[model samples]
Target: MLVEPERTAYDLRFRLLGFPIRIHPLFWLGAALLGAFTLNMGFQYLLIWMAVVLVSLLVHELGHAVMFRWFGTNAAIVLYVFGGLAIPQAFVAGRWRRILISLAGPLAGFLLCAGVYVSNRQFHWASNPEGFLTGGREVGFFYLALLWVNLYWGILNLLPVFPLDGGQVSRELCGLVWGPRGTRIALQISLAVAVALVAYSLLCVLTANGPALAVVPWWLPRGTIFTAILFGLLAYTSYQLLQQLRWTDSSWDDRVPWER
Candidate 1:
């Protein structure tokens, strides 16, 4: 799941908290496109939605960057279509360290979600609220919407699928349990999870109820049949990556650091 970026269109943006953040033009365009589809609103509201996308995704990636740096490594962030990536240049040793690095991103998201939830509640959304859905008209709606995104998306990213934070943690756990076979087992688990996800999404639709792609965000494929296609692709990619990395001990083997 971790690889060096192609360095295509790497435009250096502003810095914050000592991390030199660079953004790809595709990132903004993607966010704007997602905002346009996800939000049923006008130009001003679309702009606000884009702002939410930018800030929330930035916070999630920052969580990973901060934790990587805290572990004495160099890290940078790239915001992209689906989400952001925190590229770390240092090797994390030990299972605990690896798990910690993987967990940092989702932890950051949940933390942001909690903060936003508190703010939403403070704005009376939890009580006699005011916002897009309520009788009130203010930024409260934005707060609540972002709270939903962060909460749901954070938890979704934690699902035990390869390339996800939870998948990384699951690999560490499997490694501890199965030793050398852990990597394969982890990949197997990922494939299973991906299949289940697609099936669940389908079931939801067939039931004549809420979407089968419940976990799929509005920005993703417009919550259409492509949701199944997306999961299928993830399943295939996981299988392929497992085939590629199966030969190499990608820090998921049972070997000790020096033994590697």
Candidate 2:
């Protein structure tokens, strides 16, 4: 039925750096569906966004897979709507190794963003005084798209939220400090953060306010329904993770985050 297509789509595979890469069709479907919102930006920009997100996400996941391989095991990648996952055959031997692997993904994203930003600077978009007000010139639309998505998304991905790189990193850190109770501590921290984010998003949307701090960037996402939905999704995941606390150690590795 409906689930079959999704399964089949994600099952479509290829190889990257010798690791299997399975791309879920929803990735494309989600990007294509964004066309409605980008109608004013034109179909060309929509196409560019889709392509940029795909490539940037691939790079991010490759960072994880590459690091995983360093631990002497093969890994597989799954790219879907939100982003990608690099699942390894086994966890690395040490907590520091696991932390390094977790950090590698965001590091890759940062590097890719910097690379794109530098490559696009020659186009002279920044020289246009009116660039910021106009979303930059057409010549730099894709560049801006790539830069913003990679940079902002990469930074956001590093936030200490469960299943996120930063969250996983924090989890390992807590494990080092707290012993067997680290998992529960991590879950609690993630839930608190998720609740705060959800509350912030709701407050921004409902009260038309943002962080009171003067230094907070005005360009940071706020009061958007889309971001609200994202925070809502994160809240759901936080709830799920909280419920997963009872899981035994052996069951943890066998299931993916989405499954939990």
Which candidate should be chosen as best, given TM-score against the real structure?
Answer: 2
Please identify model 2 stretches exceeding 4 Å from their true place.
Answer: 1-6, 9-12, 33-36, 122-138, 209-215, 246-260
Steric clash pairs (candidate 1)? 124-129, 201-212
- Pairs in steric clash, model 2: none
Residue-level lDDT tens digits of model 2 in 1-260:
00112457245688978988888888787666644466787778778878878888888889989999888878888887777788888767899989989888888888988877665455554434444623355546677667777787777778777777878888898899998779778877877887777776777767667355335478876645666677567767877766766655556656677954
State the TM-score for model 1: 0.80
What value does the lDDT take at residue 106 in candidate 2?
81
lDDT of each: 0.75, 0.74
Q: Supply candidate 2's per-residue lDDT for 124.
A: 52
Prediction 2 global C-alpha lDDT: 0.74
User: For candidate 2, which ten residues in a row score worst on lDDT?
Assistant: 1-10
Q: Which runs of model 1 end up more than 4 angstroms from their true locations?
A: 9-12, 123-138, 206-226, 245-260
